[model samples]
Target chain A: MSNLFANQAPLLRTKTAPAAAALIASAGIIYGLVLCCINSLETFAVSFLAVLLAAILALWTFVRMAVKENDRGLLVTGAACMTAIIIVTVMPEGLPASFHVYRSFVAAALIIGLCVATLCSAVYRLLGSTPVAFDNSRYPILILPIVIALISYGMILFVLCLNGLPQISWQLISTPYDPANAALRGILNDILGTFMLMLLTSIISLPVGVGAGIYMSEYGGRIAGIIRFSTMLLRAMPVVVLGLAAYGVARMAYDTAWQGILAPDPTIMIGRGTFLLASAFLSLLVIPVITRATEEGLRSLPRDLREGSLAVGATEGYTLLHVLLPWSLPNILTGLLLGCAEVAGNVTVIVLLCGFGNYGVTPFTEATSLAHFIYKVMFADRSFRMSMGNYVYAVSVILLIITLGLTIVYLVLRNKFAERYRAH
Target chain B: MPATVEIKHLSVSYNGTNVVKDVSFEMPAGKVTAIIGPSGCGKTTLLRSINRLSELTKNCRVQGEIMVDGENVLKMDTVLLRRKVGMVFQQPNPFPKSIKENVLYGIKAAKIKTDHSDIVKSSLQKAVLWEELEHRLNESALNLSIGQQQRLCVARSLAITPEVILMDEPASALDPVSTLKLEESIQSMKGDVTLVIVTHNMQQAKRVADYTAFIYRGELIECNETEKIFANPDRSETRDYLEGKFS
Candidate 1:
């Protein structure tokens, strides 16, 4: 009798383990939803709908598993129990507190019922002549979380754009800020400052990045490995740290300039952030991106192309300039455009190097970009947040438009250039 | 016949492994010399040594002497040596430029002062590609068919007006029809430009080469007039290879 029980125990545990785990996970999800709903009814309703959709999906999975495993009785029992629970939970005319209680009870019952049905099917199969294998029907359930994540992201973007649409106007974008009158405030200075910063960053980073990339890929031997590793590390480094470093360098330069014979007044030349310093820091952030892109672009070319060029008596320098560079122009531009988008949206670098002071398009003056301005208005200033919340969203929309436009252009150009050199 | 290029005890090694070992030969001027061997027998390495292109590979060590026009190629400026001795690769490779630009590329790279159109016309005519591609001179070279691209590469090489042109299995990538056309181009270039071609096809050697050199395992086994090598006295390995007993 003891040996018979031991044999039954192994079979029972193997058959019931997966069903038990799924039951516990589903119950936990239901409990979390109930707690969230108790805190906020609106949030509860949304989470409850999500859970309902998930439950339906689980039921579909069970049905598929049952069919594939040849367990029709278990499928019918699970479907009937789920249908009854859904009907009970959706019933009206109960008090709010009782309805919550009833729903939780129904959810608990449904999970237990499904788990039992799955275990019974598994045990039945395990007791048969064939070896019992877990059903593969649950694989499709893995896509649920990804689907939810995408929908949530799209929903947030849609809500932000919808909220900001009414406040966006040509005048709001084209005019300077009027701090004295809340109704007349605009973002022209921020727009110009962002464009100026991006232009400066591009000027500082493009040539250096491309040159380093070419050298690393072509003639750089052991040193190229070091540079490539360092570039990757720099790309992952925090933007704020880079901004601080740039700030220190600019301050030192300013102090040194003040000691010179032809130095201008320290009050005007120093103490505040300058456009050049901001752009220099931004270049540090973007150079890694451009360098990597350029390296990949150069690496993608067939070795035969370079050999062909060299065999025709073209020098290495001439081959790189006329053959490699021209062929990889689109990839370089895509990298540059991506860098431009980085420059436009970056707030940490700008806030630390270029302050929120309003300035013209001069490299030596303190600049305010759209991102930094939004941060200043939303987080730093109380009065501005209360009065200009819609304006902040309007700036966000414009920033979104610019970055999205650049990304679209990058993708389109990459495809077009890729088509040009695709081997037949 | 005068020798256009001479290899004296030439050996090449990549990393630590020797690929071409102590190969010595002289390619006759104003004629075709074919190097025939099984795959990986170092035929291409021997051909590339004439223009010093093998040195471009990483960790590739070249020893001994390669002389072109009585000057050691290893001691001469590589760019200048390469200008004098051009190469066509196993695969057809054209620059992503217009057809006319592809022909003019070598002329421009050499910094020569000459009329571009005349050189373009004559180079294309020499490769026998002018009649078909003359109307499409402005089109990108990439759009040309594989055979046409191979001819364009030949034209581009000819534009440099090299004293010796080295081809490494130039027809290996082409279909039979294109192979015939390439052979005709090589035949037409005889007595104008000295040619050294590496091929595995014995029939190709018989059809176009004035001299045939058989290399086995990175060593030259025999070098003789194509007729004598094919018909009369030769080593056992050469006979075995020509009769397709073993690669």
Candidate 2:
């Protein structure tokens, strides 16, 4: 018995020692990689080290899973990691280096690819094997890399926004543009015009979108199928195409003799790139999104609820208005907020329909939105480009903040409503 | 009491396949009538046809008359018919709303202007849930247990003051204790509202029903007083069914 114990102790020690050593080595490599990043090493050197670190980590993870755990999730994650590594290593050269100015596009791509690979593996590990349980045991180890990646991405954005912060002041925000001296110019009119456009677009889209959604889900039979199919197709249509269509319609309306009759002063054009027209065009783009969301919300409701309402003698319209709409309010709000965010970022439709030069606040006048202003400053006005580049970024930061705030509100409200209306 | 529901030569078909062939039955007012059968025997179809809910299905065809209170339900406006004859489904399907709101829903839908709190209290009392849920009127109805939700549905239906309440296996989804509670609730509802319930549980039918109707393969085999049906059924099929010879 004493001899057997001695043999088992050595065997256990031998098995654990190698695992401990491999773990310690992996930690050392990760520390070194962080140090290299902090020291601002050459891109090639950093990327090479990243590649090596990735390979080692992949090997360690695979060995741990295969030798110790024998988990099916590990197989999925290992395959994802290996695929990501291969894609990074063999990434084709000669793609336009539009975004990466400090490093070769390939090196940047490699780093991003590696980060993506790690994220994939982490997610797979978290999801667990066959029955698809959320394995909390692997949470810390698997989630760390993903958290780091997300934080780093946010940090980069924060840095860029901070760089643009100093360029913005009360003077830059409150005053109108001074084109004579671009340095003194502010985006006050553009800001007001953007808000006006967004307000009008929301007003035009929300009711119509929600109504269409309800119709498609409830009383719409064969015609509803067509509407749904078309909406999906419209959602996939390019923004530029929508802009062109809007432009065509506006031009046709401007040329019509009815506009002359409607206006006391016939010289004033009614529909040509006007704020209302642009907003209407933007609504066309946004409606599909809102409609689809509303449809999904309605569809998520149990059939029993609808039947229950009907069985209680509620008219179809009454049920839709009182029960279905209230139940799906959160989803509808989410859709509306998402549509607003889309409108805030959109420039193509506005640029084509409402010219970038137009900056006004009234629905009757042509207007330039924040995104359109950025596009104009970046590409059209060569003289203002260098001077207003930081200012453009500032506007972008504001837009980002607004959209992010809306998204946060949507998420909070979604959770609240989801809890309230959760089916048993 | 005069007949509350008279179903005459009622046949229900879905997409050209007949589910309930020509069937006739009369349900007396202020009594519980239980329809018992094996699964897929069209007992539910017959019950749904009384309120014209069977027509909600796509390509469903209904023939003949279902007279409720001397008015043919098929000829009646659907909203009015449904208001007159409320239904509780197999599952405990409470709307995702507050308990108070669920009870008030039917009244509001019917556009009846009355004291909302009084009706809510009375209806909940009828379902025997008011004592338990009195303090939690504002709480979401979905927070209730399955049995509670089913009773809440009963309260919601009663808020409309329907002449007849149809229950489709109302106790099927419940635990035995909840089922007993539900059966008690049903028993208490007698002499106030007419009830026609479809159930698979023979003991439950025997316990709560005044009249028991047996259906087999889209046909009505027998319907009689609950005691007589259980004691000495006239038909061999009914006898075999009572003896649990076939499920």
Candidate 3:
């Protein structure tokens, strides 16, 4: 009996191992597939066909190996595999329903790990265990994290769409929200405020940010380094803190006392939580993005272009205007769009300054964005939330569209510029 | 229209390290002068000094006078100096603009108002690019082949009608065919502009240069007619460099 078992080991290494690997890999794939869409007849039938194919292939390999070797151990191993398969098919109720879900999850995880190991060993054998084979084996492991991240993001977007898509309507977009009347309920004022705020922020920030960026990249002195460090410090500060800082400045500028900042009298006329003040604060958030973008854009330019322009008798200023600035316009625009996106989604500053804005949109009016509107609606009243819960997702969907739209536009413009000015 | 460049007791240093030490030579007007040496021998620095282009390097100091048209280039306004003396680099660096615009960039930036189309035509004709690119003058300069781009760069320099054109290994990045085309362009511009070319290729110097100067270790080793420098060099280093004893 010892001699028979010892002889069977070599046969198992050559024939049985490959068949076992194939069976496990197929089982894992089918388990994952069925888990994706349970209770579907088509998925069950496909998984059944997949298992049947693996079994036929494994049987064919065993018959060939048995014919060539004529070993009794091969028959014994094949009989064991057949018995295991029969038992699994006939006695499917091995656990209760409460235990079934977690049990299958654990089983699926183990099977996936086994499949990975099998593939790695196969690759090692094919490549003779070289370092290249080791490197190749690591690729599947490296891809694991990326796959997890992509699936998580996909599921989040899927949930968002599933909950929010139905709540959006033309009426919900074109009217203003009114607590007194339900028919006039919409986010038009919030949308207009958001657009105006973005525009005002851009107006205040673009020149300063772009100029600072150009000076830092083109000039390169101690002052530029100091400016860069200051911007970095500002960028690191929390947005909520920046809101308080803006409030303090508004009070100082309006000649109001610090204690009266939150509840200034009508006569003080500080325009607290106005779009102008919000944008002024938002510019602090935006300038750094634009500055970094501009600096990066300038730096990415080929040395040849700058030297070529200067060598042709154009001064530093002239070269910047004609060559450097034009070449980096797409980069600057990308920064601007990114800054706009950041401004659009930001509600931290708006929430601290004012809860909600029901007034018409203007630079001096109380400011509220789609993000702020969502926050206000969600936390205002329990009854209100229950009555209009879906509108929160609807506003969330609109905000997502705005930010996503800006990003998509930036990508398209960047690609167009890259194609237009590709270095030869 | 051509002018001679005279370098007198010129020494250049970068961050307290000397690269070109007291090198002195004169490039004659309306002639092609080739400065040849191995890599890091200060041949390019010597050429850049003629146009004050070495000032572009940070921490660089120069203690010498480069005279062109009886004026000291070291003391000249860099913008005006560069306009008077144009340079062509190793790689083709055309602006990302139309062909006509590239040729007219310098003139426009200098605010020299002339007939734009005529200057563009003549400049391209002088660079030997007019025949091929006349119809496509509005096309982007980058779409051209590397050889064509180099010539377009030459045309750009010529559009300003500079007295001298400095070339720093202009054919080093080019394939043999492109190199040949660049050589043809150089030949076409001969006598119209004083051309100072720094190259490592001895055969290229022999082919285009009327005069050749050999430098080694940042010092002028020999200067003579091209044939004399090749056949019977005055310095042992120049002889060894020509005989392939040392790169």
Best by lDDT: 3
Per-residue lDDT of model 2, residues B1-247, tens digit only: 2239988998999999999999998889999999999999999999888887887788999998999999999999999989989999999988888999999998988889999999999899889899999999999898999999999999999888888999999999999988988888887788888999999999999999999999999999999999999999999999999898975
Q: What ranges in model 3 sit over 4 Å off?
A: A1-115, A122-138, A179-181, A250-271, A381-389
Least well predicted 10-residue stretch by lDDT in candidate 1 chain A: A8-17
Name the regions of candidate 2 deviating beyond 4 angstroms.
A1-152, A178-184, A248-272, A353-360, A382-387, B1-3
Local lDDT at A211 for model 2: 85
Error of 1 at B33 (Å): 0.6
What clash pairs does model 2 have?
none
- Top model by DockQ, which number? 2
Q: TM-score: which candidate is best?
A: 3
lDDT of 3 by residue, B178-222 (tens): 888788888988888899999999999999999999988999989
List DockQ for all candidates: 0.50, 0.73, 0.65
Taking the tens digit of each residue's C-alpha lDDT, what string does model 2 give over A202-306? Answer: 999999899889889877789889888988887888879977776676666654663322111224333347677778888988898889889888988787888
DockQ of predicted candidate 1: 0.50
Alpha-carbon shift of residue A387 in model 1 (angstroms) = 5.3
DockQ of 3: 0.65
Query: Residue A81, candidate 1: how far off, in angstroms?
Result: 11
What does candidate 1's lDDT look like per residue over A1-424, in tens digits?
Answer: 3665453322222333334334544554444434433533322433443444354345435434543333455447546655755564465637776566555455544443453444444334444313444344333244444654676788778977987878999988877765567665678878888888888999999998898889798878889988888888888898788767765665666657632221222464453466777787888888988898888889888888888888889999899988888777777887899889889989887665544443455666666688887888767767666665568778888888878877897788777776665433
Candidate 2, residue B65: Cα displacement in angstroms equals 2.2
